[model samples]
Target chain A: MTVRSGAAARSGARGRPGAGGRPGGVARLVVRTVSEVCVTAGTLIVLFVVYVLFWTGVRADSAMDGEIGKLQDQWSTGPVAAGTPGATGGQPSGPGKQPPYENGKSFAVMYIPRFGADWSKPVLEGTAVDVLKKGLGHYGRTARLGETGNFAVAGHRRTYGDPFKDFPRLRPGDAVVLTDGTTWFTYRIDRRPYRTLPTDIGVIDPVPRESGYSGPGRYLTLTTCEPEWGHSHRLIAWAHLDSTQPVERGRPSALTG
Target chain B: MYGWIWRHLPGNAWVKALVSLVLVLAIVYVLFQYVFPWAEPLLPFNDVTVDRGMGAVR
Candidate 1:
């Protein structure tokens, strides 16, 4: 009986070690748990980066396409007829008489031939996050299209399809073409890209003091985040009214060239 | 830590494994949905923009 009891005690001792109550065993377990947590955190960060860089672009492209389709449908219904007041050979309408554009609504398409032959994006009203997610967003209180003030627009430089990723490539004399289903307004790039602070609302002023223009005139301001992947500052390109042509006149030489 | 959990858990190895998986999943979900979002502002991701006045400077 003594021998049998000793055997039982030995078995109990073995089982206790396997139960992980020993100090070394606990330490190993703690290390393993911490490693697992680190692995999980790393994976989550990678997933977030993928969502921000790729998934957001996919979503924005689809949204912009849909907005463009709607705008084209509206234009095709009856507004494109020749001799319409707004469609009359791209003449700039009087101040405050341009076609009404609703906030958060897409009203035009912007094409940058210098960016790419097929580089086109919808221009929506308002610079809000939601509006920008769809495509280029117009500063709400800025000048209307082809107006005698700064028709300022903003787009993301690195995400949401990165509509202005090639903004730095723009040079003086490059054309920034905009169309509102009736008239094609072409603005000649007048100033190279320059950096500015985010709070510089004057960049979109009727007469952008920074553009070296002391008097009010027709202007266009294209703004985007600088440093490609960072928004620490804004990169702006200024343009002046070059010409206007009706859509019925076919694609402009700036677009075709 | 795992050994203590293993000894305290009821049932067989399968039960312990299932319980551990559930615990891990709950921890991950809480960290992602609550902890990470709450900690975002403390990070530098959204610190890109500066609110200084508009001056044309690089």
Candidate 2:
């Protein structure tokens, strides 16, 4: 909003040079160019902030919704062959079974009542950068839905639809439900989110020592960046499988409620 | 700098204004569509993964 910037500066510069003659022209032009450059850089930085804080959310909302819709369409057309290629036709969560979902492809949808009744995000197979841009990502090496060991998932805490934006709102008994077209798996949180360094990979181990579980059991790990918009640390939450029901038996009460 | 561009914009006041607006919008579009997407991965906001690939554990 400076009066001496932008289009207005042209006339000002032309007239102002008359006061000092040609000697001031070169210095005036240099100062003007430097100021213009500074202003343009400032504008770009502000635009980048807008793109990160707002435009990204806009793009990610649609991307996540598109992924969810694609999964639903695939599930409706061919429930068995849609995902879990080898473990088709029957329940895919057979204790030791690993529902080897296609990498970068969404295989399930997760719903957290603590976030909101309508809050749901597709769970992709891998945690790679592009994969998470669509929605939540299932840690490839972790347990599959309702299976033994740790069924861990990761999601954005700030952008990319902010699937776990309210991750800290989770309570000890809050329900985290997910479905893989054939069954609904509900897990209850063991505690609120625990803040830790980004290097704490053991929090997703089969028997996470920090999760209060002394033995191996069906566990769920949710991870996101700490400090909301900062990734200097991570926020983790552990849950244990509470129950499972066939998809035909209707959605688990955890979701319907 | 902007003053020079405005002087050479070759139009009436209204047309020059329209052209300037379009140019600015085009630059923003490219930034949002191409530049921002490419730069996002370089930022820390999207680092949700536990970095198991780094072999850094605590």
Best by lDDT: 2
Query: Lowest summed-lDDT stretch of 10 residues in model 2 chain A?
Result: A82-91
lDDT tens digits, residue span A1-257, model 2: 77557668787677776776866888889999999999999999999989888887898889989988998888788736433412232333554444377899888999999899999988898888888888998887777776668888989998777788888888899999888887778889999899998888889898985888998787899999988988899999999988877776899899877
In candidate 1, which residue ranges exceed 4 Å CA deviation?
A: A1-21, A78-94, B1-58
| TM-scores of chain B alone in all candidate structures, in the order given | 0.74, 0.80
Reference-based lDDT, each prediction: 0.77, 0.83
Q: Which stretches of candidate 2 lie over 4 Å from their true place?
A: A1-20, A79-99, B52-58
How do the residues B1-58 of candidate 1 rate in per-residue lDDT, one tens digit apiece? 4566788988899998998889878976686556654654343323222222222241
Report interface Cα RMSD per prediction: 4.8, 1.4
Give the per-residue lDDT of model 1 (tens digit) for A1-257. 99999999999877887776786676877899998779877988876676567766788899999998988898989556344233454455676665556889998999989999999999998776667778888877778887778888888777678788889999999999999888888889987898987777678788986898878777999888777766567888999978888887988899997
For candidate 2, list the clashing residue pairs, or say none: none
TM-scores, all models, native as reference:
0.76, 0.86
Cα lDDT for residue A50, model 2? 90
TM-score for chain A, prediction 2: 0.85
